[model samples]
Target: MALLAYRDKHILSAQQLRKLSEHKYSCFSASLLDPLLQPWWNWLVSQTPLWLAPNLITIVGLILNVVTTLILICYSPNGVEAPPRWTCLLCALGLFIYQSLDSIDGKQARRTNTSSPLGELFDHGCDSISTVFVALSACISCQLGHYPNWLFFQCFCAIALFYCAHWQTYVSGTMRFGRIDVTEAQFSIIAIHLVSAALGPEIWLTKIPIVGLSWNYTILVFITFGYTLNIINFLKMFTEGGSGKNGSSVAVSIASTSRNNEAKNNYETCMKT
Candidate 1:
């Protein structure tokens, strides 16, 4: 079947096409920072030229983010050594710009009357790639590579949580976000970069006298707890089943039913003729 698909010219199946046509973007984010940033996003979109395409804006932001992160990686490839203070600042700025632009792209599409399912796909595709870079950059900034296993765990955990978020969306047909979510996490990383820039990455090596733990380790512990909670939440949601009829995954079940109904109608029409 895999080889047969490779031989075929078309990628998407008829049912996939039907699902795409019927697709409606549904997202629910109770993010702590999104509401606060809405006004800023609205103003940014207003200033954006009508001639500028939404996709172009998204791509530019993603490129800037990747390039800045790559520069940091080049300086500290092993993640054990701290990159230059300026590089951390540059990375923070790059991430901020990317976050701002990402928030406004959908608004730009709606403003231009050019919204489509493809736009959503493109936006999420960029985000999925960005998650890895962001995690790596954060780890490097904190010099987490000194503990190689921890560094690997942090990066892969980030990627896994991102994937699981989309998987939840696939099942429930609605993207759900908690109060302290992506925006909050991005800002926290930006703060980490800024702190590294000002006080130097060595600051994270400072041990808390009472706790006898380095700042880096303390933060990592907190982040680990957050990841554990997220995994538990995802597992609970998965086991509870989706909100769709008969406890089925919403999008897949709806698409399957629609395709079946369409085929039945076609057969009935042929019989009448």
Candidate 2:
């Protein structure tokens, strides 16, 4: 099953690596991640011969995601005057751990011949839960204390991102975010949220100085604008990005022929003097 491998050696191109966060698999949503995980995939491929049998990275990530979600829920920022900094730190760490391992397990599979459709499904299934929890916690924390509008927008934006991701995959056979996709945006968002979690909600919140409106809420309005616009841009690409070609054998044949010509150009470049 090349689709599901023993050692998950990803085939991600360089540009995709930088924007892995925006990368999406469309169908499996996360399963398509194989093409965007190069260095981590490479590491797992290196372990192919021995077939390392440590606990699965996806399992570890799932556990951490759950742990973080639980702590955030049980000790919500709204409920407590201040949840323990340690608890907040741990929650942030849990998400971070999830982020890193999220990229690691597929490579492990491809490297070790452990890639299974089941594994791919499991990996993504857990990620869906992770997204839900992370968004919920962040919103609850902000809403409980000071930034209600921001919380509203954050939660809405996060869900919007996921929904758009699903839509892109269904329509294009490509999981995209803005001009990017899940592969390009995932790690970057993780970094952004993790830093926010560490700083506590106030740092970004203070950016607001509205005469009447709370600046936090104002920020959310703008964030909403950005989020909605990107989703729209992604949709627009469907209509405008590719040349409009209907279902025609000749058109497809021409397109296929063009692809070959482009490939030939690439090959010649590789062989150039």
Instruction: Write down the TM-score of every candidate.
Output: 0.93, 0.58
In candidate 2, stretches whose alpha carbon ends up further than 4 angstroms from where it belongs are: 1-55, 77-81, 141-153, 177-215, 237-273
Question: Per-residue lDDT tens digits of candidate 1, residues 122-174?
Answer: 99999998999999989999889888999999999999999999888878888
CA-lDDT, candidates in order: 0.91, 0.58
The positional error of residue 152 in candidate 2, measured at the CA in angstroms, is: 4.7
lDDT of 2: 0.58
Worst 10 residues of 2 by lDDT: 242-251
Question: Pairing residues by index, what is the TM-score of model 1?
Answer: 0.93
Off by over 4 Å in 1: 1-9, 13-15, 266-273
